[model samples]
Target: MAGSLWYATAAPGPVLGPLTASVRAEVAIIGAGYTGLSAALRLAEAGRDVVVLEALEVGERASGLNGGQVIPGVKHDPDILEEMFGPVAGSRLVDTVASGPDVVFDLIRKYEIACAATRTGWIQPATSPATLEVIAARVGQWRRRGADVELLSAAETARLIGSQRYLGAWIDRRGGTIQPLSYVRGLARAARGAGARIFSQSPATDLEETHSEWRIQTPQGSVVSAMVIIATDAYTDRLVDPLRRTLIPVPSFQVATEPICDELRQTILPEGQSASDTWHLLRYFRLDPTGRLVMGSRGTFADVPVAVAARHHYRAVREIFPQLEGIRYEYHWGGLVGMTRDHLPHLHEIAPGLLTGLGYNGRGVAMATVMGRILADWALGMPGPELAFPVTPLAPIPMHRFNQFGARMVIQGLRAMDGLARVRDRWSARSAPGLSL
Candidate 1:
């Protein structure tokens, strides 16, 4: 795996204890990424005995390798969510994910975690007239719900994003950015401080229900608990066949330039808002604490040279901001994003005493942390009817291996279409007036 900017710059995490013997806890969580660590913190703070078993060190997966944009809400808009899940459940779901950034920043302030959190905002810039309409609908829905969101004109969008490539954008003030690796490690530290036992290098080899309690078998130890929470999103393995099959892991790649001069830093992402364009194969860009321009996009499913993998991102920076020319990239990394068929995050009670919360699409930083709290709530006896998000059965996609293979071709096709759309929109802007909401 490539070393990410987060791993290269974030503070070192606490050393975890080894799991060499059998242990019993009220709840056992698998995969100590954002979800598991978040749940463990809440559970231990609530005076429950929680044990977390991680395959590797904390934040070694998506939680640590992500773009660090703490974007609020899922892929679907608020009204669409209500229509899809029905009025009551839909409304609750809307409120839950819409406050995702609040959940993350609140945890940071509460725990005093030093992750370089910035709440300037998150921007979704439109690449063409069609995407401009999509963002307009989203802004209207959110504004009606009393969210602090606004629509930006072409000039305003260009100012904040430091790019003339976008015609406009929708800004959500509640969204922000953070040092993701440091944040996840901070969560682990807080969970341990609150009386949770976390063990690293402990992969849950097998999980089975013996009698009424669940036993998770690892290499050198086992955990017997009444409730089991599978927080492993994209890194899920064969420990539970049905749960793993329910998600498709799509690889997202990112690269960061070496810290630029003060002049360049002041001109790019001037207000500190992270922005991702509206495209089928979208590209996101942000500035790290030290002024490194971080660009993220899709990476190939198969391994290739670092330069080859980061080729698209390099082109993005050049096309969007000509001033960034001659800047050298310093870091490149990739991680799998758990994408669902419907693009909605799934919460499943796969079996008695076994539950999972995954398929965050690309909004793992905020949504995954929200899932942790929800998982803790469910373990604390929250009934299904009272929960905001609906819990459904795991419906594994047919020919899962085939879908993963086919996604690569689909990504290439989208890339071509996106390029054409960009060129068309740029020509349209030069020929006539730009589009409006």
Candidate 2:
């Protein structure tokens, strides 16, 4: 199987050469994912000289490897965000993320990106009655904030998902999916067209702050700019110690089946909406434009074999969609996701004129795009109060060296809990009158 289904499917985009000479720009961005590329596009559009330094080809890492779900909101609940950041700032944060998919689709239209962009919406299915209540609370909270979300009954969810495994669901019309690699590549092309200098295979190995400018050093070149934005999320390096330590990188593995027959496709996600269940170790799935079923789940961060990790996802697919039994998987891949301590994205000003945005948990698609714009606005002298997420100081995680061990333990615990929850849910269902499936 191909390492990445996205790489096999997405059309080739622009090929930018590596940087070989020192350059100066008004702003320098490290990393070439959605956040960096989007920021470069905005900054270049504003007539500022911008340079994007990428360690590899754009979207070659997490950006290209992630499931293409364009989900809305950060990892935390809306009400919790409101309570943590207070009413005004927290509400703005909620609204900003709630509109994330709109921002993404708008960019696709404005740039005429050819990524198989779909706005059919996203569904969060509840695996049990307790999870259904959680989904209900989420739907109500978003609805009260004027979001176009609805709670689905058990029958409604089953009909939509073509699976009776879910108790209910929360459907958010604002969410959708995209060809992530193509989208990121398109953003890079747009940024270049807007006059942002992008260099591939040029990693920012060192950074230093001069009296009034930031100096970023690559292997073959260097960039001197008034400000710099470190947009590398899960792929952060030792060049940015504080930012790297703030996130625990976890592995997310995915597999995509060969295109199914049209008849079978019609019975699976018939509405073409993306869906994920409410398990602690969540399982997410969606149909590609060509009717291929793509599913993903958590994997080990260590050097565990890919096939071993993938067995879990394969079992999940069989359990959820028995009709897909014996289907051939054409691709299997995995990438790291930067999980923050609080399960929310962090925007921090490491020092004067040096900013960093990372730690999206797993919702990097829309949130990263929105965060790019936020970083651009901040680079353009926007005040902290005006941004959606609060700009705070970077805080390194304690005992950071043990993060890998901790992450593995957490995944194991979550999986065990999920197994127990399934047993309990089935027991409760059989005991309740008229609830047995």
Candidate 3:
């Protein structure tokens, strides 16, 4: 099987070469994912000289490896965000998050990016009655904000999702899906078109700051710029040790089946939307443009083989859609998601003229694109107070080394809890008088 179905199916990407000599620009960005490329495009279009150095080819990391769900907003709802960050800051954040999908779709249109972009919506289904309250609460918050969101009854969810297991769901119309790798690659093409210099295979190994400028050293060349942006999310390194420490990079694994029969394709995700369930160890699935069913979940440790790692997802696919039994899985891949102590995305001004945008906590497609634009705003001289996201201190996570073990344990416990809850919910429903499936 292909390591990544996206890679196998993606159109030819832009040809970007490695850096061979030192260059100077107004701003230098590290990492060539959505964040760096988006920031580069904006900065370059603003007539600023920008240089982007990437250790690998564009979208080779999290940006390319993600599940391609362009979901807007963070894990928290708008009301909670406002409560946590105070009305003013939180409101700004809410607005920023709400517009994330807008930014992504706009870019795709403005740049004419071809990634099989779809804006049908994103569905978060309740696996059991216990999760209905949470889903309804989330729907209520978005509806109160006058957002394009709605709650779906169990029948509607089953019809839309082609799954009778779900009790209900909530959907955000602002959410969508994309060919993640192609999207990032197109961003690189657009950024270059806007006059940005991008170098693939150019790792920013050393960073030194003088009185007014920052110098980044790569394997074959270097970049000297007035300001620097660290856009690496889950693939962070020691280039900024503190920044690296602030993230818990967890692997997210995915599997894709060969194109299903047209009948199955029409039944599953028929509205062309994607879905993620409410399980503690959540399961997210979607249909690609080719009709392949893609399923994703939190990954096993690195040493596990792809087939072995895919056991859980295979089981999930069977339970979620028994009709897909005996389908052939054509691909498997994984990437890291940078989780912060606080599930919120952070924008940090590390020091004067040195800045960074935080990880998206798995909401990278739209959020990362917006974050890149935010980084560009900072580089364009926007004050920290005026930026959409609040600039907070970068504090390393405590006992971060043990996060992997904890993540594993959490996954196991959540799996057990979700299973028990579903069993109980099924029993209660069966016992309820006059209730029918």
TM-score of 3: 0.95
Candidate 2 structure lDDT: 0.88
Q: Residue 48 of candidate 1: its Cα lDDT?
A: 98
For model 2, give the 10-residue run with minimal summed lDDT: 428-437
Look at candidate 3 and tell me the lDDT of residue 338. 86
Ranking by lDDT: 1, 2, 3
Model 1 lDDT on a 0 to 1 scale: 0.88
Please write out the lDDT profile of model 2 over residues 345-407, one tens digit for every residue.
899999999988888888989999999999999999999889977987799999998976887
What's the TM-score of each model vs. the native? 0.96, 0.96, 0.95
Cα displacement (angstroms), candidate 2, residue 242, comes to 1.2
Candidate 1 structure, TM-score to reference: 0.96
What is the C-alpha lDDT profile of model 1 across 1-437, one tens digit per residue?
A: 34688988887788996689999999999999999999999899999999999998899999999999999898888888898989989999999999899999999999999999999999999887767887898899999999999999999998898888888999999999999999999999999999999999999999989899999999999999999999999989989988788888888899899998898777889999998777777889899989999999877775656577688889988998889999999998989999888888999998888988999988889999999999999998899778767898889999988987777767777777667766675523211111110
Compose the digit string of candidate 3's lDDT tens values, residues 256-316.
Answer: 9999998888899899999988776678999998899999988877877767669989999
- What shift in Å separates residue 332 of candidate 2 from its native position after superposition? 0.2
Ten contiguous residues with the weakest lDDT in model 1? 428-437
